[model samples]
Target chain A: MAILELKDIHKSFQDNVVLDGINLSVNKGDIVGIVGPSGTGKSTLLRSINLLERPEQGEIRFEDITLNLPLKGKERKSVTALRKRIGMVFQKFYLFEHKTALQNVMEGLITVQKKPKKETEQIALDALEKVGLKAWKNHYPKHMSGGQQPRVAIARTLAMKPDIILLDEPTSALDPELVTEVLTTIKAIAEQGYTMLLVSHEMDFVSKISNRVLFLDGGKIIEDGTPEEVFRHPKSDRAKEFFDKMNKLKEPEFFI
Target chain B: MDTKFSDYFSVKLMWSRIPYLVKKIPITLELAGLAFLVSIVIGLLIAVIRYKKVKILSPIATAFLSLMRGTPMLIQLYVAYYGIPAILRIFNSWGANIDVNVIPKMVYAFFALGLYQAAFTSETFRAALESVDKGEIEAATAMGMTYGQVLRRIIVPEALENALPGICNSVIGLVKGTSLASTCGIIEITYQNQILAGRDYRYLEGYVALAIIYWIITIILEKIFKLVEKKFRIPEQPKTVEEV
Candidate 1:
């Protein structure tokens, strides 16, 4: 079942068209990995779904809500309602610097959801436990490792119980050695059956976690299929070349 | 015709004046404290107005910032002391009920000093507000926090942390600026020192005593701010993965 549908989404920054007439449908529990070269509008596509980029033209249908792009004042309430359902995790983690991990997770529940303090704390604690950071809940982002911080960020999103989680290059900002912890945390979340749209450069990790794969190139999804079909048998020359280059980078190199 | 340094600056006179000067310390602190409270309130207001680029108020805030920053603190004090009455008189002329005489010199001092400090502090606050990462704001927004909620919860707390050192600096400046309140006939420590000096022509002793008092106050304030900074300091992130 298509849980979220985006129809003819178009976004441009001045003369530069970042997303040109893109269309997509995401099913329930589908971990869709959006892989593309840098500046290929992969992040823009994900951001537009939450009305962050304000697509110049599009219509989004999720659950009973239909949000037309360039949202008018009356439709603004629906954007908030829409966002509550579609949570996003950023590349930079973006944890509130002044808050502890527990507080960061509790903030949305207290402020947006208007949940009671006692219940919010319990929910936040449980979310932190899921990310395997229950012990570090009192620690601030700066005190935690780069890998640990993103886990807190994921916990923050997970506590919100959004219908779909958008992970935009969630591990791209971390040091190579620190990437595994975040990826492992994400893989654990996927196993629990949360629908997620992930934009990532970690081709191997994406393939491992995602059931569906989307190959975006030049502001459009050129290929969308099952991981096995898209990863092994890319139809377009661009996807084939991109995969080839990505695969080449993965192999260890030595200089004598 | 060789006058000794003792004649110019009598240690005995300075010692004798200490008790009298100390009596006025509370008044000086009161002026600075009240002015600081006013500055913080107005400064944050102006900063938000400017930061948000509030349509009607933003330009006015910019003009006010320019006027305050461009002019001298003494002139602002003079303006508040003198101009307030002039304006009030005009209001009275138009049949408005106002008693300008009831307003105190200290109130004018507070008004002028607060307005002056607010100009500088607003910049401090605005810069701090801007320093909050856009990504964090987006994260809050993505979690469905409204604009007001984002500002209150995420932007404000983080900005306040960043603005603390700057605010401390402004406060020290404001404390020093309170000395100018004497110009408007507000009897603070400086004015008390001047009165003590006028009695015996011991200007050097009085000036030296005032300097020592202000220096000690500045040192105490610095120590207090250091403790506060330590208490609220966010731990520094490890620079490299090796450190992590």
Candidate 2:
């Protein structure tokens, strides 16, 4: 059975249609990469899956629960439960500005799971250790670099022990040298067998890490296949053009 | 021509009022303090009501804030002191025998100041609440936190840090505004100054003394507010958002 499945998902903002008849399915332990040009609703699709953005029309199923619109009541409860099964990371690390690194990690455990302080502290510390931020446990996000803050954010989600993880351009905001460190941590996490959905512009990382690659253009999937199949030989003219353009472009050392 | 300088800066007049007026300062502070505390409670309740958009009551709260903000504070003081008593007297005449005087002038002052500032305080709190990032709230909610727990644990504390500077300024304004309560015979600093001036015929000195006292109080308050702001400031950090 699929861990997550979406069928005919449709959403539009004002007059601009962002997602039209979007369909996707991911099995457990799969790592899927979504790549697209700017303004192609990549972030919107991820947010819709989490029910942060309600779709105008669609069937979205995660495990046993299905949502046609944003879920509420028992359905919302299950949605939250499903979210616990899914960890999410963003390009701009959103750490609680007021909390220390350890406290930020512990927040979900103590507040959400109603865990005792001592136990939550232990769990949070372990997660921080996993992210190599154990020494900075007492430090607030303000005192850390962008890369360090995102690592803490990752630790925060990992503390929740989710079954699947989502990375929304996770390293897009980092400096070039810093991007490798974050991706290396993610690579390690993937090696540990966590399922992932990644939206990224890092074609190389997508080619390396993805079990399947999805190319989105103008809010619909243009191509979906293995990296070797899509990167080596392009069936679509748009894919060919995009790949050629990426190759021809002179990206700064820090940006790519 | 300048021989009547004693009339303007009479030590005798100012010294005589010192003991009596000093006693009255406490009364002013008491009234202002009580009113400020009450206003905070009323303001927080109204803010929470409006923030939640609680159906029928939310609009009522908004309208109440509008009325309080629209009218002059003095008019509100008069309605509390005079209009309320007159309505009570009408009830007394019908053999209800309600002694409206049982409610003192200080109570009227407290009500007038509290309700008025509550309107502005609610706005301050609303702005403070908005300063809290939406992600914090979402994170708490995903963790299975109830709305109340999220507010009490995460939202209110963060909002307090943001709102503190404005609230401190408002408290200083409240202290100055307490002078209006003298019109209703609350015997505050302004009232004592008036009484002292009437006896010694040195009105300027008495008013000057009151002005100095108020200035001192506010300067001290501003220092305290700065200290509090420095201590409680939300540290500037790169704002990060987690995806889950």
Candidate 3:
């Protein structure tokens, strides 16, 4: 059964339409990897699900609740309620600079969830431990490595225990040397059977981890299928061209 | 024409006046302390109003900021000291039960100094509030934090930390500003020094002693602020090689 359904989602920045009548359904425990060229609205689509970038028009049916887009004042409460169930991780990590890693993870739990302080601490610590950062819980983001910061960000989002997690180019901002550790942490999270929608430029990593692949171009999904089908047997010319370009970039001569 | 330097400088008198001048320090501090408290509250309010561009209140705050910034501090002190009682007397005439005569001069001093300092500190606070990374706010919002929660947890703590240096400067400025309270006969350190000088006619010595006292206070405040900044310093990532 579909746990989340987005119907006829349309978003525009004045004259430039970013998401053009896009429709998608995400089932429980599905790992959907979205790949597209920059500025193709992959991030916007992910953001729209949580109402971070409110779409001009859409109907979001998540579990039993339905939220019509361009939310009215009365519907705003539901939007906040909806956001609680859909967690987002940004490319830049966005860890609270004033907080320690444990505090960062504990913040939403304490403030939003209103969990007891003692219980929240244990939950936050466990989340940190899951990301392999239990010992570094007291460290602030700046004191930690770029790789470690995103792992803390992951812990922050995980502590909320959202129904679906959205990762938007989670390793894009990291240095090349730091990318592997964050990816490894994310891969570990995926193995725990969390439902996730990931927009990534890491083609090999996405293909390895995601059961489903989506190819977006010009604010529309050009191809959506099993990872093997999209990667090895793309039906659309755009997908084929995109994958070919991606494959060519992997060649050692391309770097030189 | 053979006037010795001793004619103008009275080191002994200046030393003797220190204890009397020091006794008046509390009054100066009280004025400054009350004014500082008022500034923090009003300054934060004005900053929030202006920063959020609150519909009706924002323009009023802007006008207030302009009035505070454009006018001289002396003019504002006169307005607070004289103009307030004038306005209050009108309220008194209409049976408001306010005793304009009984109101303390220090209250007026606090009002003037606080509003003036608040104007500058509001700008400082607004800039500090703006300096908070937008991404962190978004992260908090994405995690289901309400706007108020985002502000209290993420925005304010960071803004306060960033505004520390600016606030310290304002405090020093306000301490110096208390000297103006003598215009209303509030008998603070400067007024007490003037009284001592009036008796001895050692105006230069008295003024020099007052300057020394203020200089020492400024130095002490600077040291305190430095310690505070160190205590609250957020560890920053080392700048990248390219940035360096």
List ranges where model 2 is wrong by over 4 Å: A70-74, A250-256, B45-63, B87-98, B134-150, B234-244
Error of 3 at B111 (Å): 0.9
TM-score of each: 0.92, 0.88, 0.94
- Candidate 1 per-residue lDDT over residues A141-225, each given as its tens digit: 8889888999999999999999999999999988887898889899999999999999999988999999999999889999999
Could you give candidate 3's per-residue lDDT for residues B1-244 as a string of tens digits?
8997788897887888788899999999899999999999999999999999999999999999999999988889998888999999999899898988899889889999999999999999999999999999999999988999999999999999899999999999999999998987899999998888888798888888899999999999999999999888865653232210
Per-residue lDDT of model 3, residues A1-256, tens digit only: 8999999999999999999989999999999999989999999999999888999998998897789988888989888898888888998989998888889999999999999999999999899989988888777788888889989999999999999999999999988888898899899999999999999999999999999999999999989999999999999998899889888877788444
Docking class of 1: acceptable
Predict model 2's lDDT versus the native: 0.84
- Segments of candidate 3 deviating more than 4 angstroms: A251-256, B1-3, B93-97, B235-244
iRMSD of all candidate structures: 5.5, 8.3, 7.7
Q: How well is each residue in B88-167 modelled by candidate 1, as lDDT tens digits?
A: 99999999989999988898999999999999999999999999999899999999988999999989988988899999
Candidate 3 docking band: acceptable
Per-prediction share of native contacts kept? 0.67, 0.27, 0.64
In model 1, residue pairs whose N, Cα or C atoms come closer than 3 Å (at least 3 residues apart or on different chains), thus clashing, are none
TM-score of chain B of each: 0.93, 0.89, 0.94
In candidate 2, the second chain superimposes onto the true chain B with a TM-score of: 0.89
